[model samples]
Target: MYMLVDCSNCRTPLQLPPGAKSIRCAICNAITLIAEPRAVAPPPASSYHHQQQYPPPAPWPSPYQTPGGPPPSAHGRKRALIVGISYKYSRHELKGCINDAKCMKYLLVNHFKFPESSILMLTEEETDPLRIPTKHNIRMAMYWLVQGCQQGDSLVFHYSGHGSQQRNYTGDEVDGYDETLCPLDFETQGMIVDDEINATIVRPLPRGVKLHAIIDACHSGTVLDLPFLCRMDRSGQYVWEDHRPRSGVWKGTSGGEVISFSGCDDDQTSADTSALSRVTSTGAMTYCFIQAIERGHAATYGSMLNSMRSTIRNDLGSGGGGGVVTSLITMLLTGGSLTGGFVQEPQLTACETFDVYAKPFSL
Candidate 1:
């Protein structure tokens, strides 16, 4: 005497045993109660059973909500982890890196609908005490990137700090040496090398995930006065230095897919204070690069970098400041190829009749 039930909402059919009192739909995840004709529970003697069959209240929205609501399509969202090192203790100046990161985060989240949980931020005050070998706050970020990153996910690594170089290790081939990122607690006794960064975050990333690294420091063969151009393995040692590269371009042997955006060139100093009101700025190049992207002028990475270089040169009143903006961005595309999508797609307003997607940077 099994009772057969069918869901009216999703139209999925279900089977309930004679004694079964309730059943849930398999398609829409909705619940339905099964009542045997003779086994129906009577309402209170004075109450009407029709009142108990009232409709349910509407459900709330999911965490992943878009401008109108949940996206009409089931598209994998743009996931990102942004880190800005604006304030440092022993490290070099990073006046605007953190601010730049914050702005970039806002663009990605609000404009692109990237989940708030997906974005990670690190400042001078936040540090992971347990992970001593790596940068203070970077360890948590690395942990999340390594474990959570999936194929097809896009990752953005933005750092506004000092960059240096060291003689290539015996087995290393490219560039005859390697570039390094100076962590917050980097000690002169044992410099933190870029290899560690690669090992922790870059190397472990899942396949099909697009990796973009923006470095707003110097790191050519030689920085201002410090000879980062040619040096021995000083990974564990730290030297208080200035004029280092902010970013570099490289890939893993297994075809590591990565693109980097550098702030300045190797020999020049990346300006922290801007000419625009001297109102502290964040990763100079990073800020401008994002501005172009958010504006929708950069349909590709190459276009975005070109726009950044032009804008920076115009804004700062100089063409070459030794920042690594172009080099880092070009590296992401493997020596220049278009990548990056138009974040916002235009739609007519409730009262308007024209397409605003063509409008200048709708997002």
Candidate 2:
């Protein structure tokens, strides 16, 4: 007996004999199986087991679960890697970067309750050869952050150092510039570009895990290559824009969550030794962020953003502190604004703006 069938892989029509086990399509040169139905229904646009455009369904509900749905739970784990490069003798050295990383580690451990051992620190003063914030160390540390990450895991990647922009040769960046983080060996090994950063941290993550990147550097907006940049009005509404039109930048939420906060716009620079405060020195943005988080106030994305912005404008004056960074979360009861108005902006890049039933921000 003979039968007519279409190739499942290439979708080409073929003439076949009964009991044929497999066939090869001539047009697309794809092999397809002729077998009994294993799946009850056709998969969606993509399969969870395989990689595709939109990520596959996650195994658990995310932080901001839909209302009345199952509550968000921590089934995986939490880890962090904080890198602060002083670049001691380098021409691009700064004073406040190491301070920023240490302070953030304090906040995570004392306040947010992150495990001390789970936190990795890479700085210039490290005696261990492996802990130095060189290009190789930073890259390895990034892998360590997301390695073995599973659903409900929370991870933080904080970088405080010299950030610069290079001419975009790869077309992955939309603004014709590729943001870079200068490691201690940047002069020799070259700066780590945004593309490499994304491929390292964002692409490998599975759904349900959350990554929060607090990038306190120059030209850091969209540094992680997150797909959606969230814009919020002074009132309460928000709109998300594609970070790049032609680029297929990876979003962490394929089966996990990724939200990156950058210190400034791609064309602008973040301040290091700000003249605003009485302290020795600190990244302007990092200082304000620490202050806000330390307040122990219940923080949502909106509330935290306003608190940081407001604290800076009030104490530092306009442009006194060049620290303004933004992040993305699913949803919470965040509805507040900075009192003093300024054009100083921070950028928030999310995966899909999944703002339905998320909870308040925590560690």
Top candidate, metric lDDT: 2
What clash pairs does model 2 have?
Answer: 64-357, 64-358, 206-255, 206-256, 207-255, 207-256, 208-255, 208-256, 253-256, 285-323
| Candidate 1 per-residue C-alpha lDDT over 154-199 given as tens digits, one digit per residue, 9 for 90 to 100 | 6666666666777855444234555666666555333445555554
Q: Could you tell me the lDDT of residue 100 within candidate 1?
A: 65
lDDT of 1 at 283: 50
What would the per-residue lDDT of candidate 2 be over residues 136-224, giving only the tens digit for each residue? 66865675576556778889999999888899875767789888999998887778888767766776667777888999888888788
Q: In terms of TM-score, which candidate is strongest?
A: 2
Q: Can you give the lDDT of residue 42 in candidate 1?
A: 20
Q: Which stretches of candidate 1 lie over 4 Å from their true place?
A: 1-77, 88-91, 125-136, 171-175, 188-191, 220-256, 265-269, 275-278, 318-363
After TM-score superposition, what is the CA distance of residue 37 in candidate 2 from its true location, in Å?
41
